[model samples]
Target: MTYKSDSHIRNPEDFGKVVVIYGGNSNEREISLESGQSVLSSLKKSGIDAFGWDPNQESIKYILNQDIDRAFIALHGANGEDGRIQGLLDFLNIPFTGSGMFSSAIAMSKVLSKKIFLEHNLPTPKFKVIRTLKDLKKATDIFGFPIVLKPNSEGSSLGMSKISKLNELEDAYKAATEFDDVLLAEEFIQGKEITVTILKNKTLPTIRVKTNRTFYDYFAKYKSNKTEYICPGTSDISEEKIYADIALEAFEALHCRGWGRVDFMCEKNSIPKILEINTVPGMTKKSLVPMSAQCKGINFETLCWTILETSF
Candidate 1:
């Protein structure tokens, strides 16, 4: 099931008409547009009959009329990644890349994903759900200073904040709640940030993220040129195996299929703590998944074609 290339697909015509869905009315629309463009260009370069569709500019009904055989989801956040579009495509009987509706719904909610991870005995940071000032107070008492506050359901670190004192709690909560009514307060694991990319149930080389900023925020993810990415995240083979194993376990536990990315925070000599699962990760030039694939000798076009095969 390891999709290293398009070896199984002898001809691009077999793919039929493909639609790269992206740019929904989500806060991550800009990122999604870039990702969708990248994927669409790659598909065309590979001779696949591909077209880009932006939900914000058009309607879902229009896609049905266009005779799109399958979809390559490049959208992120809200309607795109929260299972709404997946469900719609399922009802229309069109296969799409990435997880099913149920899995997508669960993974979109950080709170729900954490519950599944804990149920499987997976290592994840301690967290508390916050809906009010009182809930934030309770969480601060448990996690103390330098706690991470983020929207319960968001991506690209859109509404995430790290607070180190009581005075910063309200501002952080307000910021996160701007994206989602519910928020998550997690224990800030002081360690290296690494991400694992999974394609067709196979793990790609891990990438360790380094940034001079306080943490890898939206700026560092897509905008910052100073950010450094170290492939094979850890030098030790055993440690790399640990990250890959945990990533696969987490992906399966959530019933996520196709391609995805699992992020982690690893403290020295400590087990890596799961951050969150990205069902439809970014596909822009600066994306981490492509970076990991490149380390394994899989070019971006090949990677895009392999992901499209998942719809089959």
Candidate 2:
């Protein structure tokens, strides 16, 4: 499938002093820094007056005094992807790239995203919200072995674990709860790990991720060099379209605007189950969105410019 470049903005002057917000207090701070730097470099290369802002090192209120016209969010995890910054941007009447407050908050939480997906009759892995050890035990009993435990509001698969036995349950739960009070114990779907990138409400292409590690954890996402990405993940056009169609539906169901990425787990001869939506996906070198976008001939600088167009 061919994807037309969405780069409609011809002048960097149109952006008028853009700030790439990233490196917050979230555990994904390091990754966000990398993403922010990459985006900052691209935006500058495209001749945009872009700057990097790390809320962790400086006060967020300083942004208001900087006369910044808009923001290109590179932050991940809490305070970033969870809508706090989006709310601030909305309150300040400053347009930013990616989804608004409500959608960002909903998309950041795996529990909430799953609820919305189920309500829309979208296929998603069965999950139980766990607040206590008893709740974890109950979920384990229901889902049996080989279940997945993850923090509800974290991203980049941090504090996420796939348990293959009962002995690993306590450790997984302990690890996940460190990130968020609420946890999601989900039924692990053994299948192809697929992701779809959506830009300006259009699905770019599907990507299949292969990793030697136990699932796509934080290490596999950023550190592992062995990870392989397959663009247009499916072999047939019909299958690819099916994935793309469902991905767009899922994005709309979450009320997500601008750009985002929809994740899925697809088993052979079965429907793909939606995992979650990423409102502000990574812009790092190893990120999936850029890889999928590149497959459609959208270079990094042009992609950054196109995403900045979403701010308008």
Candidate 3:
């Protein structure tokens, strides 16, 4: 990915001593480690004073003692992206990148986010919360076969399954429930998978994802080489604007800030439905945010710098 030259860079000393927070005890620790390391290296390459700190292996006091001015959060899932760490940082009076506490909390919950989307008439897929066997039965009655089952708060597509029949529902539900007490059974929309990247309150570019696997599961997202990402997904400028508008609306509806990504499933006839919002998107080599950003003339290093600038 290549980026055109621009004037977005700031003085290195403006960042002070920065800590790239990643690799928590969350299920996404490995991916967080990769993203955090990538971010740390990028910040250093950009001439910023940056260091990596893993909350799982280090104490908060150690980080506080480092005299860090701000944090570039790369942690994913659970205590990381779900507002726990955001609250901690707020209490510490340190500015960090990405959404604030409440927005992060809402974005982390699939059920709550979808509920807000539905209430606001945002174009999200129909869903039902599955907690008991009776709730599962209700969901089957509502969505029937070919539904999606996944945990409410996990990221990186973890604990997600597509159910095609009644016989498969129980196993899929079991798999999802093992990850979170709150699971969601959603109507399956067969279409092209796409995502919109938001940076500094501006929509960067749209990415259309095509995967050979069952769906954009964990493997297809991070590990599989077969997955392809296409930027500027549509040929028509108006259609792209429509998708961008909806993505921006969804981001604002959740009160998101700094930077993030909104995913969509474009159904037949080019109708886009909001899937979910990613508050702290992956920065790994295979991550989509950078792919989308690159299409907008923002290289990985420049992207990290731009995101870090949000701390102010």
Candidate 4:
């Protein structure tokens, strides 16, 4: 394919042909903005017409009026990654990066994702969805103590808590309820924290995340350097292959495409259990997905460009 220079261009896109959707009504707005900026910068550096569009009043109106060819999603949590924006882009007939509506919806909801994983016979921590406080005990009975209590439909670990003792369950339950009506009392698998980043329906590289803290909580994940990550996960080639295989299967199982990340808990028993899938993985300098992608000779700029080019 021959490329044209600016002088030879008939009509160049000044405002950019690629619109980046970011910073919506999500708790992760700050990180989303960071991701948007980074992606925009990389796209611009790579000679692609790209610009950031926060999902605010003005941004929404402008995009609806504009003629961008495709969109790059940088938003996370809530209306951003919960299939709402994907549905909107679909309505506009604009091809955007990342999974589609059904896949985004399923991956965003903890309850729905766990169900799919369970149905696929994938190793995921067993859990019970608590419809009411009265059902907490039934959940604990099924999952046992040291369980992770999380809202069924939230992301970025917001309103998620790990209850090790019986006395901690109530408070954790109350906290998690602030985010959603339904909650999952997942059986906490005491082991290593790991993640898999996928792009274009392929697994990038497995990362074994080790934190100085007990687990990779919200604080440790985004705030503190309490975490240590091992690309390909300290596993031998064969073991890493196993993880990559499972990760790919889970990604396909969730119907994820374009790009996404799946998290897992690696137990000492050598069984890696599914945690959940992040349709919109963070793109900050410290994000894990980029780390995995970098392991395969794909820099952040190149990675962003590849995803954008695919949108065409």
| lDDT by residue (tens digit), candidate 1, 154-232 | 9999889999989988888888989999999999999999999999898999999999998999999988999999998
Top of the candidates by TM-score: 1
**Candidate 4 positional error at 159, Å:** 1.1
Clashes of each: 0, 0, 0, 1
Instruction: Look at candidate 2 and give me any clashing residue pairs.
Output: none
Using lDDT as the measure, which candidate wins?
1
- Every model's TM-score: 0.97, 0.96, 0.96, 0.92
lDDT of 3 at 265: 93
Q: Write the per-residue lDDT of candidate 3 for residues 59-91, one digit (tens) a residue.
A: 998797888788899999988889999999888
What C-alpha root-mean-square deviation, in Å, does candidate 2 show against the real structure? 3.3
Model 4, 195-311: lDDT tens digits are 888776667778988878656777888899667778877457877767778888888898877778888887786778889989889998889888988998899988887666445
Poorest 10 consecutive residues of model 2 by lDDT?
A: 1-10
* Preferred candidate (TM-score higher): 1 or 4: 1
Order of quality (TM-score): 1, 2, 3, 4
